[model samples]
Target: MAFWRSTSLFSSSTPSTTTINDNTINQETIERLCDRLQLATRIEDRRDALRDLKGYSKKCKLEVGTKSMILLADILQGDRTDLDLIQLALETLSNIMTYEVDNNDEQPNLPQDITIQFTELFIKNKEHVHAALDLIEETDFNIRRTSIKFLTILLTNCTKTLQDIILESGPMGVSKLVDLLQDEREVIRNDALLLLQILTRSNANIQKIVAFENGFERLFEILISEGGSDGGVIVEDCLSVLLNLLKNNPSNQSYFRESSFIRRLVDCFALNSIGEKHWLKQKETNINLFLQVIRILVSPTNSNQNIVACQRSISQCGKKKIES
Candidate 1:
């Protein structure tokens, strides 16, 4: 959580010199920790090994660029049997990443060093080389949930480079990332949507690719199923991601104009107003996102059919209004 605040200096034209120091790394201790982490038979033993390493790195304030961080990421890929192992791996990776780029500013793009490090490690692990694809398919819900955090750390901080990784993994990985939007785990779904928001807003390349894969259609499905439910923080995020995907993204405009999103937009208003006024405040925010989406989807130069459709949709949102 703290890592997202620390903006990666690499995102700018003039990247700052990495603050990660490497000279004092006690190579023997790191090797010993890695060996024990891989070989320990007992769950506590394994977790302790990871803990020691976490402390080791933190004390040294290692940059995520080190092979030690890469090793921790490797621990994440296996068909892990121990929940503790998986959790330790997850936390260890989280700690290393935060040490590398922990900022309080809440910036989005990850530094180039951190991005390249994960990419290289993910490439080497090969167990889940396809990334979110295999990880999302894990039978363990906890594992799946942890994957959400790990993947978020990777993509949110680095836009284009990470997008290139998914694109190279082909449509399956990309589709898996989208499928995450509908995950039964609310946090997973929210994280997936957040990642998609980054892709659509900052990475135009992924936006067009997502359009081809029926991403907008799938997102609309999320709206229809989860709209106006006060389940979690996902409602506004879901709506916001769809808005970003369709905003100025001309390729998706056709689908949005013809989409049940129009109807859904109208329904969100219904859900927010008198019919479901109990959720008025939260649902109203969703309605605002919907309205902005409508404005973007219907351009004067694009199609009057869509414009007229949007006009009808806006009117439908007010249909629930009562007369004195």
Candidate 2:
């Protein structure tokens, strides 16, 4: 969702305060956009309506809350091939349904209760969530990226409900998200990584599904490619997803150990050009997460064999570090 930045996706249709008098969106304008969306038969007209709706949504999200979700979902479900229309609709929905609500008494865009109600409506109707999920499969970059962003927001709103929906989407369900991890596009890969971290936390069934998709192999591969601790923020995100997959999930821990991915995990600690004194914030964070992953594998509660295997891996990593 990249904070629902309209400029990034639609530079031409960026929201302008001048379009809405006094930086306020009137109800009349809102209804007109809805009418254009419903009655317009031409593809261009519908696109224009959605674009305008997206602009208005940015102007005042509370005014657009829940009121336009049905129409937006309809566009998502009814028109899959129209990339422009879908991207606009998704961006509009993202703006309208953000966790960032303004509680200011003078100009409250969305109240807490309204936010809950909006989330509940989307959750109660599984179709809306599924529609967004299907869009992730689209080849169009903006459509796929926007849909992923929208789902991230939804998941953040109500984790349990969203997690259940994604899990019920069958084996291919989690696979779609997992596939994004390998996408050549770094931003898309990073977005997918963040979503996976949230989605897999404390959810053993989903974790198993992810692991089956060769999750550990792909993630570690990315870690090594990114230069491990020396890599940018993407490295930390990758580690976070790995942590979520293994944390408190004994089945996943055993699977990780059995898969013989420990060697790959140790490789992350290999020394890089940046020494400890020159380690930046992200590098420090990444090293801490790597340490956390090591701690999890070697914890006492784990079977002695697993702990010993992890210890051996650590000793090997240390020896490599010393010999270098």
On TM-score, the candidate that comes out on top is 2
Cα lDDT of model 2 by residue, 1-324, tens digit: 022332332223456766545443365777788888989999999898888778777555655653577888888889987888889888887766664535332224234454455666766789888888989988788888888998988888888899999888887889999999988888898899888988888888999899989999889989999988888888998899899898877788888877777767877775654465677888889889998998898888888887887788778767867797
Model 1, runs deviating above 4 Å: 1-31, 38-47, 55-59, 63-67, 77-86, 99-129, 208-232, 271-284, 300-324
Write model 1 residue lDDT over 263-284, tens digit each, in one string: 6555554443446535556655
Task: Assess candidate 2 and give its TM-score to the true structure.
Answer: 0.85
Backbone clash count, each prediction separately: 5, 1
- Candidate 1 clash total? 5
lDDT of 1: 0.61
TM for candidate 1 is: 0.68
Q: Give the TM-score of each candidate.
A: 0.68, 0.85
Task: Report per-prediction Cα RMSD to one decimal.
Answer: 7.6, 7.2
Worst-scoring 10-residue span by lDDT in model 2: 1-10
Best candidate (score: lDDT): 2
Residue 246's lDDT within candidate 1 is 68
